[model samples]
Target: MTTPKPRHLETPTETTERERCEQWTDQLFRTSPMVRFMAKHLSLLDCNPLSPFPSASASSSSTSCSSCSSTNPAPAPASAPGQQPKLVIAPCPPSIAGGFSPSLPNEPTSHSSILLCSNRIFSKSHLEDTLSHEMVHWFDHCRFLVDWSNLRHHACSEIRAASLSGDCGFAREFKRRNYAFKLQHQNCVKRRAVLSILANPACNGDKQKAERTVDEVFESCFGDTRPFDEVNNPRLNFKATDEAVY
Candidate 1:
């Protein structure tokens, strides 16, 4: 008689649990190439959320700005060549309220030449998340080089950025730090869903509609929960990965 292979030692449930944990760990460690690529593009803008603008003479580029005298300078150049051109941040015009709008929230209409916003509020860690979120919008606008005429297109761009943000290790870290602040100030359920949508590559479509579905799923699990402070949070301690869970 032929010898039979020995039976597996582990029970089915144990094996399944082990597999699930492995999958989770894999996700936790996965790195997103897309996020890295986009970050490469972002580095070109050279805007530092932490500091005020530096003088025009200090910048490497040809562009000059009257506002740089008052604002913080950008962080060291992080962008790659052949990427989107950088913009100068300047003071807002009196005509605009709150000194900015989501459409062009960074600078005043008078200084229309700048590509990125230099405003202090946009640079705050939490606000940087918003700015990063908006930059994704601008990135799409640049990529298509046309108006996002359809709802599907808008949804696609947001989804793309969100997915990239989740997988992009640096972007995710930036988001986590920024989000930590918001979590301290207000309910994080909605914010978490927004972050989830940004981090998840699967949620793109019909912007408003997609948001509703995302919101539902988040509420079901988090239920208006506030995240622990970033200093003490366990989830933040994990390394970034392609398969990482948020």
Candidate 2:
């Protein structure tokens, strides 16, 4: 039997969170029809990445997608032709990461990773929400080879992640009993989008630049949800306060 690629976790909790990540990620991928569609097109490379074969070429030995990312992955290919890319779920420094599609420089691995900050508190529900949010980035990278450095592209993915991940739903607020502010859900998303955007190195801790980028792409990215119909969307009324978003 082919071995599943090894998942890398940066902390001692790696053993535990590995299972948790798989459980959460797989469950979401299975149940969400839109997520399922994205996965089919992804042809997610599951490989024995941690250990390399001696005979393998450098390109095949590592998980590099820069070459493969030139085009959209074919739907349901029986087998992808390159070295399988592992799905690395790891603990990241809160200042620089939460979860994202990163191109690791030193390793030159093409595999994608989602790094959750271990220093912060995380409930199961919170973790699931994070996974869902970052998965959009992964989907965008897989399909569009998105350049995270581009503030506009990053903001667009952030928009879709916030709007589609159910992060701005009233039901979530009701559950948390956090209804003190007007337009609480949308504002919460905007706040989160800003935070995520600020984490990008390009922001250099400039909150204004991050917020401005979010504002510029907010409507377009928030409105565009390919592979998903509107019925599955959250009740987000961003258009009304478009002028007042700042």
Candidate 3:
């Protein structure tokens, strides 16, 4: 007999957090031009909701779209042919703000799932950054031949995610006190990429292995920005100039 997956009842606080995150996610999907562009182009715009939490709800609360001024926002166009992956708001490891899980080999067309940690995300910007970061993984999954099991492949995607998702933008780095006068953006991307790669089980928590893999993929992955025309996606509030430390 197969063992059952564990389930948990959400506390009142957890429920509140989940609802807030779900609303923000829905809002970004509907209203953010960059998010909409990526979702549509990547064919990940429509996502069925799934969760292991007991309070899992399949639909988000109806909120008017500010862009269209419509009480009922128009539904996203149907996803490309396949079993579309879900967008889940569930508990993740305390350290993870969000993640993307690729579909199994048998389900090639279906991209996979994007997970948002209910307890880890604190504000709208945090949610936005996390979603965009995970979407970069989704983009790589769809557009490239990614071997998720390979450390170099995983490192490449993480590096691209960090560079493109505005995770290492100057303002954010400044806030984090990562003040380096030279190659600040590159340094930030490398640091974040190594940390993210270490989270993968294949790295075996070897910081050196993760760092080395990141270096191997760094030059190529750091230069590749496909869906977005450039690094630091135009839709992000921070400008490219902000990345300059001088």
Predicted model with the maximum lDDT: 3
lDDT of each: 0.32, 0.52, 0.66
Q: Which is superior by lDDT, 1 or 3?
A: 3
Question: Residues 1-246, candidate 3, lDDT per residue (tens digit)?
Answer: 111112246677777787788688767877666565555545432322221122223323222223321222322332233323256666666778887878677765343767788788988777877887887787787667588889999989988888878788777798889889699989998999889888789999999999999999899989877665566544564233312211
Model 1, 144-186: lDDT tens per residue? 4322333344344444433323322344445657445434322
> Against the true structure, what is each candidate's TM-score?
0.28, 0.60, 0.76
The worst-scoring run of ten residues by lDDT in candidate 3 lies at 47-56
Summed backbone clashes in each candidate are 22, 2, 0
Higher TM-score: candidate 1 or 2? Answer: 2
lDDT at residue 9 of model 3 (Cα atoms): 61
Least accurate 10 contiguous residues by lDDT in model 2: 237-246
